[model samples]
Target chain A: MRARIVDKNDILKIVDILRKDHEVIAPFQGRGRDSFFDVVTDANRDQVKMHLHNPYYPPKRYVLPHIEKLFDIDQAKMDVKAAYVEPKRAIFGIRSCDVHGIYHLDRFYLGRDYKDPYYERLRRGLFLVNVVCTDKELDIDNGCFCMCANTGPASTEHFDLQLMDLGDVYMAVAGSPKGEALFADPIFKRGDDSHVQRRRSILNEVRKHFKLAVNWYSAAVRYITTGQVPEELWAQVGNRCLECGACTYLCPACTCFTVADRKVDGKVVERVRLWDSCALSGFTRMAGGHNPRRAVHDRRNRRFFRKLAHYFVQRELSMACVGCGRCIDVCHGDIGMPSVVEIIRRGCAGKENDSTIIKR
Target chain B: MTQPSSNDKNIYLPKVAILDRVQDEIQEVKTFFWHFENPADQEEFKKFRPGQFAQVSIFSQGEFPASLPPSPTEKETFFTVRTVGSVTSGLHQLKAGDKFAVRGPYGNGFPMEQYYGRNLVFVAGGIGLIPLRSCIIYALANRDRYKKIQVFYGSRSPRELMYTQNLREWEKIEGFEFYTTVDRGDADWKGNVGVVGSLFKKPDVKVPVENTTAFVCGPPIMFRFVIKDLKDMGFHDRDIVSTLERYMKCGVGKCGHCCIGMAYVCTDGPVFTYEQIKKLGEDI
Candidate 1:
């Protein structure tokens, strides 16, 4: 990795350099506490906040959009044409946890036997600029548990460039060749060993600020892997779920989607794919009305099993829950990952040797 | 930004297939015989094994997973679809020359070659016989590789029976044993008038339990009752095989609709033994 230093005010110069060849997207503060990632144009480039709360809506939509067109079918000609788009875009000011989310998506979509062309296209064009969460006042949310998930305040890799704020000057570390290429710019200066030391001390100081730190992550993983969690605990968790699918939609690692075909005109039909969730009963329901996971509790159990089970963790080579805590912010009920881990820990406290009953 | 062209090997892209003919099997069920319009795709698809399935796309309706009913030894590729949903209904409206698209021969298919020199029993109820038809025809085509083969099929009534043409042909074969039953018999019907399980109890019919592999496919109730009968007859759980059905969007394993516990039914199996199915911890 190559290191450089830039003046605090010159952080916008980095965005300006990226916007020359890419459509730069950075976070902006919204009404009250709301913040979102939007395209940086000439007019609103100054509004791109350097310090703000991480957006509840993940940046995964950039790679896997909410609704994506798969193909277009010409009915009269009986021809199917694939709808493929790959825009040269850079997601600036992305947090560490969200960067891990994209890595997990990479392991899932491109690391498999059958590669998803749509996901691959968007992913190839992506340039990630991860911003470290060093400011306790603006960056750290009460619900964030990235410390427990071992993803942040600064990720080790997967981002093209990483920027950390250090009061007087910003320390920029290049993680890839694309990032190192920006070091030739006049705004960036050669960094010394002192900048590295400051980054470590600042990260150590900010690590103590997270309010929700889940210590029972490994224990929950063990219980879930061994199928030792009781049915009652899942039922209680499921009862609290409103089934709005907000948790899945906001979570950075959820990749399930359903496909549909719509008539664009009399002669053309478009096949589209939409993000889907396991919480919905209709997700697993067969056409004839036979649903394997008909009960809400069963669906809830699946969500946790897919996240923490050793089989899936081993298959993807990464945990599905990236500890971003977006699920906590979006969930109407208190059944987020940290809360669910606490429930499992308490439920299995004294029942280690007892026969575990998992109802289907 | 330049427009990205489609990849030639895109997994989601379904190859156009032209329908050669259509045969009405039962009241709502029809067998569509089709081949890929491209000779390369048709040649590549001929390697599919028994019990594998394909994702069929009917232009305006949607895509659905349908089992490949034709054996590799058979002269043509076809799907036996019962018009139960909008996708299948769209398929039913297509003429002989009409075109649709198909991808894969996905899922782990039945391991038929492993049952060499063993007696095979196929039990199917109604439309459940669709997937099993591929294996049965494959076994019959390579009869020298196996011993006694028996087929027991039942439907709700006389008109609901599937593959009547194949059923008639199997009855006349020398070594093959074919038996049919219905829940309720019609006025002109003369076959057994009971559940398919009743055929196992016929005095003249003998089911070899010593070295046999039983394939069961049907409604869940019939599956349960048939498993009980097979277990009572001293059949091991591993010796009984079945193909499962689930709502699937991707014939490949990316979509999570067909996942059960730890396994994706699309990739790990749509074909599983009774012992493996029990460990899935989900209902059929």
Candidate 2:
């Protein structure tokens, strides 16, 4: 069927419509230069920006919360009940790369026998309304290596309404039944041939402008098997390692967590699940007081291996790096994956260059 | 107990258990024996071996590692817990029909069959003796299957000694030497007065290196000194097996809690050699 069109200015109005039935979340620029998705309400109209680069953290945080209470137990009765929460949310302005990340999480959480009810709850509620990244500075500074990673400057799955901006008006293609139903409302109108052609050209332009080229498969392979390479190289790379877990936090595909049992009133309380990074020192501690990977550098190496070498290689999917580059900006040490990949390439070429060579 | 085996994943479920018995071993330590009221699990406890442990879950309080002081050979079921933290102290108040949850029979236990013919050296300090107590009693029961048996136990003071009555019963057995020591002796005490490591000073109990299997457990400081002494006394790292304590939230290897690099203490071992610990690059 023919798609519908809506003016760029009226995007917030659509959000107002969805808020009646769901909690509408949109991109709101937070402190510094970073953008994060915040729930859309009338109070933050000026704060919500529909057209911006990817956020400091992916949408995964909302679905898979950093700290979640999984289940609660009653000490007196000895009966246990799951802490189930269902908040209906409409996620507006999701970038294509973030959508791909949510897709991976969908498979990880839903594909397994033990389903994460918390993630599944928000996931089922989330309605995607994706917008095009028209700003080149947003594309470059964002550090999204989408083409090499082969996710997209646009997504084909997961998203409901795909909004491609054509300067004045936006061509809104209804990718799913929900999108079609939403489009059938009074606000949107049926589009002509030229509008659809305009969206095709706009998407093509976004893809043409994508910067930061990478050999994704080679980069992933090298990251896992890069052990034979010298520690001096990793030392040079490791020197920049800030030991911050931002890379895993921002990446759309990174999913490792830890659980803590929080007590209340001397009873077996709730199982609180939090985002855990292997970069932390206590990540591998056993009860009898044994900690493996005690060094900061080894933990740093483990994060890289987990994303590029381990989970991705084993799953035979692209390395979990969505090329979001939140790690680059978040890292105070300036030792993100892009610089690490350059070092890997240099090492693979057998050149004895240091960190200074990669910087230039 | 013998390490968790081919039973399916559900074996690790944390179920509510009632505290049926409690025994105070020392000022800060108490042992609790519990049973599953669900009736079905009363049968499930049949498979665990000596030296295996469970993650005792005290709701809202926290979970801690405690070994099955009762042998798997016993048809009756219970776990012996020592009160060390808030969760454990809370457990001391629990009595018959009071419920708590437990997840395990996790991690590898002492290799009983492999150590059958070897002289067994059990070196324990304070409550470290709890996990080792099962193996000691099991070996004592099957006395004919093993070689020389000896236990070198030490506690902070005479008051801190656990299972004293049981230790006395074990003392009366022939060919079994239960050498008890205290860091400092009280006026009424009339036993060896020194660290358990002092037992090595006596010459007649020298164990041959080739046919000796030693098991050690205690606070990290005690294990540090004791392991060094054993290595110095011609024992290889592999010949000595020690149970490790780490924060293991899930008895299965999936949770990152009990991980030591690639090794999950819940899966690969709670019992390991110095050789395995060396590759981990982690502190013990």
Highest DockQ against the true fold, candidate: 1
Cα deviation of B120, candidate 1, in Å: 2.1
User: What are the TM-scores, per candidate, against the unseen true structure?
Assistant: 0.96, 0.69
> What are the chain B TM-scores of all models?
0.97, 0.91
Using Cα atoms, each model's DockQ against the true complex is 0.79, 0.21
lDDT of 1 by residue, B232-281 (tens): 99999999999999999997888889999888899888999999999887
lDDT of 1 by residue, A24-48 (tens): 9999999988999999999999999
Looking at candidate 2 chain A, the ten consecutive residues that score lowest on lDDT are A220-229
In TM-score terms, candidate 2 sits at: 0.69
> What is the lDDT, from 0 to 100, of the residue A287 in candidate 2?
42
- Fill in the DockQ of model 1: 0.79
- For candidate 2, the lDDT comes to 0.72
